[model samples]
Every structure is written in structure tokens, then in C-alpha cells.
Target: MHTSPLITIQAITKSFKGVKAVDNLTLSVGYNEYVALLGPNGAGKTTLVEMIEGLQKPDSGSITIQGKTWQKDAAFLRTIMGISLQETKFTDKMTVSEVLDLFGSFYKLGKKVTRQILQTIRLEEKAKAYVVTLSGGQRQKLALGVAMLNNPQLLLLDEPTTGLDPNARREIWDILMQLKKERGTSMILTTHYMEEAAYLCDRIVIIDKGKILADDTLATLLTSYDPGEVIAFQVSSPLATNSLYEIRGVKDVHWIEEGVKGMLTVESITHTLPVLLNLVESSGNTITSFESRKKTLDDLFRTMTGRSLHE
Candidate 1:
């Protein structure tokens, strides 16, 4: 039997001041799926997400969650999803437990569920700690805990770890992975971090100029679009870009800092690296630093859009 998708969007469009923020876009999310929406700022990721969340209405087309439209099923739709925005603020006087209990109360949940939520977010030790005293990461966990109070089936997270440090970001990732593993929660996460999207999402959708440029699994995106390995290095002296391209297996060369620092996309490192080194050495251009790795989503995005995710 074929089951319907958990969320369905068809040709939805939204505009502001005669400018289309989300141009005729269609997308779907499957049950128990984790999807990441990656795009540069002003790419309409947030606009699309807002429409899906029923926080905003599209100018045209339709959005349905579990086959229910927001116009008619707004109440029921609210019950099944949890949202964690880029930033969440809580009263400074409220303790961690108190904050959870307060949000839980909105869903008519009690102390037992609140206790479980604290444990799930690993904030049991900070139950008595005031919200103001919590670190940035702990505050994010609390925001996540509040979102999960309803035991929502679908989670909408908008850059939940945006300002967090690496260690703090990993902690947020761990909690989200746990939720997906134990509860089978479906999620739509919007993030600026390629590493976060690659690690946490099963499917990645890259949007630009209010349109999806690439949508697929990480491997497919990497392979289908200019499949290759990446070599990034700096040299003691400037090197001609055309010279690097002459190496066998070299597909493309991108200079990060004119000729002194650059990255190359090659069909095989084994074939390209030795030749590249010999050429550099013969030309009297010593390598300052060198590294090689598999092509990543970051590379794919740059290839397609000619811009970095942060740019």
C-alpha cells in the first residue's frame, strides 16, 4: 500500500512589495523523514517554512499537513507539530523545570511529562536553574524541550543552533538525533551550516532566489553534479590557474585567494596529486599547506550557485 506524504505543498507562492519571496514551489515531506532546507539568507527558506507552519498564508496554491489544509484544520494541525525558531526567549525568573511545565500546561500536560522532557533534553540537573543563568546551548535545549512538550509528530526547527559553539551545536544535534531515533519524529530543519545539514538530514533541498536548485540525498548531489574529489592548498608563490587545469583528472580549479591559494576538483586524487606536486615543485612554487577530501555539499552548492551558503 502506498501511504500519503506527511506534508504536501503544491505550487505555493508568496510575495512582498511586488517581489516574490517564494516563487511557485512544490515540496513534500515523508513520514519519519528528516529534511534540511539549505540556502543563503533571503532565499525564502523562512517564508516557505512560515507558510508550512500556518504562521503565514500563501498568495496562491495550497499546503497540507497529513492531508489537512491549514485553513480548515488549523486546530488539529497545531496539535501535531512542534517548532523551535532561530531564537527563543524565556522569562529570566523562570527555572528550567518551571519553563517546561509552563509550556506543557498549554497542551494540558502535567508534571510527569515535564520530568520526562527535562530528562530527554538532559536538563534534569538544571531543573532548578533560572533561565537567565543557563548558557546559550542550555537555553536552546530548553526551547527544544518546550517544542517537544506536545510529543509532536512533526518538528520544525529554524536554525536552532545558529549562534551556538561547536560543542554546543553538537549537543543540540544529539538531542535531535535521539528524538528521531526513539520517537520517529519527522522534521524540517533550515540551517546555514553544511555540516549540520549533511550530518542530520536524510534528504537535502538547496534553495536559491526563492527556488530549489538541487534536491537529493547527499551522495547523489555530490555525484550527479560534478562528481570529484577536492584539493585545497596554498603555495609559496603564485601559480597560473591554467597550469593546474592541465593536470590529468583535474575537472575544475577555483582560486580562494587569487593564485597563491586555490581548490581543485579532480576525478581522482591518486592521479592528480602526484602530477600537481611535481608541477608545483618544477615551477619552484613550494606548497604551504595541502589537503584533499571527497566533494561535499558545500562544494556542490558552490558549483551550482557560484556562491557560498553564508554569502
Candidate 2:
């Protein structure tokens, strides 16, 4: 099976108050593909996707969908694209069903599509519940349901799990995976959670400030960076100071005094932890416990940005 590129963004740039927000950003999303847009806050992710949705125009460049997506022909594109943003703009008093029905009116979809969306979002029980009464998770589900009312071929999710509890976030993640399976819907997912990005996206675009820092499959992205790994254990004080250099793959081992904190950092995950553990045990140090610390997306993002995702 073959499909055309669903969206093309060429050198798209945007600025606010003379400060550049998006800088020469270029990306292409293939149809039925899942792409994770990851970066710390203020990374211009929202600005970039808005331009692709035709809600905002780029300062200098082009955004092209398969067909015209301007407001003039939005009626046509509406059927092919669904968008769920981090912010939910629901009127406090409106019932879930009322809001869903209202949004459905904008798309001219029939009951079949609306009903299916409601079921997929698991809002049937809360269909008549007021928006204010639903939990944050249910509200987010409703937002997704509304987005899918038109049976969109492409879905754009902007930090879909923001502010969600761990359980709610996991629920939404499962739903997204299911959508890709049942509908074969192409999705552009933006998030600050590296774990979620690593879990959901087949490929990822890592942006820092206003530049594309890395773009590749999750494995490639992890492998290409020196984000590395660490193996840490707490035990009795070490008998030998020079043993630091003896542990295999210990890129740098500086034993610090956190009461009983003992640590060995391996530069690469390719390094074996058994050797480090064996050294700790044989050294007469109490082998209290140990864990391998692989370089997560957060580690990579923080390494590049020098700040946490929330920062």
C-alpha cells in the first residue's frame, strides 16, 4: 500500500514581539504515520502546528497539505483532519453531550460518526454530564471525541496529556494507539513527556529553542547521543579509593558521601552492569541495592537544553 505525504512544512518561521519563535523549521509527515514533536516549553511547537492548521500564517515559508486547507476550503479539509489542543475551551455549564453535539454541528457529520466518537472516547456514561462535572480525564476524552467527530484522516494533538494524572495519561496513550490501529489515522503528537514520546512515536523530531536538534527513530535518536547511562548503588564506605578506575565501563566514578551513596557511571549503556555490581560486592562494600539508569528522552532533552522540560 502507498500513500502521499499528508503534510509538508518548508522553512516555516514565526515570531512574536520581534523574538523569533520558529526558525527555519522544516518537516514532512507521511500519511498514516505517527510523529512525536518533543521539546521543552516555549519550543514553538504550538506556533508551528497552528500554522499548519491554517489558524496562523508563517512569517516566511509555506505549509501545504494534500489539498488547500484555508478557511475557504476548510469545509473540505475538516473531514480529513482532527485537532485536540492542550487547552480545553469548554463552556463550564454545557453538558458533555451538548458540547459534543454542538461541535458535531460544525462538521455536518451524521449520528453515526458522532456516536462512534462518543464510544471511542468512553464518554457514553458521561454523555449527559455537565462539562464541569466530568473529571479532567473525561473532559480530555470528550475533547478527543469532538476532534474525531468528522472521522478525520489526520489527527493533530497538542500536548494531549498535559495536566493529566498518571492514570489518565496512560488511558489517553492507549486510546491513541487504538486509534492508529482501527482507523489508520495519521497523527502529529506534541508533548513534553519524553517517556510518552518514546512510547508513542515511531519517529521523533526533537527541537530546542527554535532549531531541530535531532530527528530520527526513537532507537536511533537514543543511540546517536551521549546521553549515556549510570549504575548507582549504596553501600558501606569503599575500602579502596583507586577502585573507581577498576569498575568496567565506568566513564567517571566519583564516590560521594550522601551518607552511604555509592555510584558508578558508565558512559554507554553498552557497558555491562554485572561487572560494576561485582566490583561493588567484592570490594567489601555492602551491596544494599542497585539500578541501571539509561539515558531517557528527558536526559537527552535536558542535555541539549540545559533545562528540564517544564523549564
Best by TM-score: 1
Q: Which stretches of candidate 1 lie over 4 Å from their true place?
A: none
For candidate 2, write residues 254-305 as lDDT tens digits.
Answer: 4545536645546754556666557667766666766767766765665666
Tell me the tens digit of each residue's lDDT in model 1 across 233-309.
99999999999988988989999999999999999999999999999999987999999999888788899988877
What C-alpha lDDT values do all the predictions have?
0.91, 0.77
The per-candidate count of clashes, in order, stands at: 0, 0
How displaced is residue 69 in candidate 2, in Å? 5.2
Error of 1 at 280 (Å): 2.0
What's the TM-score of every candidate structure? 0.94, 0.82
Q: Mind sharing the TM-score for model 2?
A: 0.82
Backbone clashes in candidate 1 total: 0
